[model samples]
Target: MTARLANKRSFPHPPHAPPADSPALSIFSPIIQVFSRELQRQPDFDLLLAELCLDHVWTEPSKRDSKGEVANKMFLSHNVLSQDFANFFIGSLGQLRSIRVVHTVSNITTSGTMFTLSCRDAAPIRDGDLTVVLGLDNSISFYSGHVKCAVAVIAR
Candidate 1:
């Protein structure tokens, strides 16, 4: 029975290639294939791809250039810091076009190093988040008395 079963069934051969005129064989297919191959060549492609995918989605009017074609824009904001807790801000322009850094001030006085950050735009921080890291060289200190500080955001 085992010998008869082995001879009874045969698997079909795999297709060598997709048909030339198949709708799936459009120019985008080859471009996607090449893009995927190129992405595979990069060591950190997966991480980069994930970050790109996670960026924000926004709708804004398109400005026409000399070419005069409609374009879409995307905006995103994020923050990052070193293990030592040095502050920094990462903001994304529409379509990842540019990045703006928010200036951070570290004041070292008799009390301690006080860190302050100011945003240029007067608009409320819609998608703002902060991250803090404490390190040996840059540790947070508590003062005996309450300290008051005021922050103002001036728009351009």
Candidate 2:
């Protein structure tokens, strides 16, 4: 039997990236990309990402500087044993701006540590949907509970 050749199929090319003059994508691109990969890998990624995003979107506007910018502050206290660990973790908060250690009560524990941090924003948190904020994940948690505790305290 004789065989016939078929023409190659063509698909349309995606439009070019937005022009530089265009307004930048609100600060949620990285979060979207990372969460997208996570979602592809695991079914529960959305739940995890959603929970984490909640903390970022929750903030108090009462604590702001004269310029009306959020001036987040932290209260870190630790015993001799936890001093180094605490400092190291705090240092991990890279380029920490609008945040400071306003109150510190040292020697609060014989061999433990504590921190009370509050994070505010220039604008009030949105009622629904992801509110994009930059530099949120510059710091990472070493221990299991560190991130959750920090987020909870900051939101409060």
Candidate 3:
């Protein structure tokens, strides 16, 4: 059976031109790194394309097949995606803390966790500011070949 990425993006030609690490692609570093690592687990699995928006990491694999081999691979990628999204949007305690302190491994709710992506660091965040919120879907499974990381951030 033919396989596809989570978002099922249109697969272009086979002329592979995977990106090399550069400053421009820094925000997507987390997904790229995670996807690259998974590529190693499957010798035939090459990363044809990758795009990280909000919380989901969409990719066009060099080849697609049943999700029999990369079960553990998706687990690792999803784990990193959640952490990076949280850190980039929610920030640390002093950055954007709530009255209640809750410690959990992942902030993935069924409705998708809210966090921020992209850069908003030229000026320091003041007490009152409105930022575009994004959400990442936590209950997704890339191994199932249906990864959906949908996500946001709005705070003082």
The superposed Cα distance between candidate 1 and the true structure at residue 130, in angstroms, equals: 14
Model 2 over residues 1-156: C-alpha lDDT tens digits? 223322222213224555434455435577888878887998754553432121232243545423343324322232223332121112233222221122235322222333333222211122211111223533322221123222221231
Question: Stretches of candidate 2 above 4 Å error?
Answer: 1-11, 17-50, 55-66, 74-156
* TM per candidate: 0.21, 0.17, 0.16
Better of 1 and 3 by lDDT: 1
List of clashing residue pairs for candidate 3: 56-149, 114-152, 115-152, 134-151, 134-152, 135-150, 135-151, 136-150, 136-151, 137-150
Q: Candidate 3: lDDT of 14?
A: 33
Q: Rate the local accuracy (lDDT) of all candidates.
A: 0.33, 0.31, 0.31
Worst 10 residues of 3 by lDDT: 92-101
Lowest lDDT block of 10, candidate 2 = 122-131
For 1-156, candidate 3 gives per-residue lDDT tens digits of: 346563345544333633455465677888988988888888886456544223662232436424322211111111322321122222221121111112345543222443223232211112112222222321211110112233233343
Q: What does candidate 1 score on TM? A: 0.21
Q: Report the Cα lDDT for candidate 3.
A: 0.31
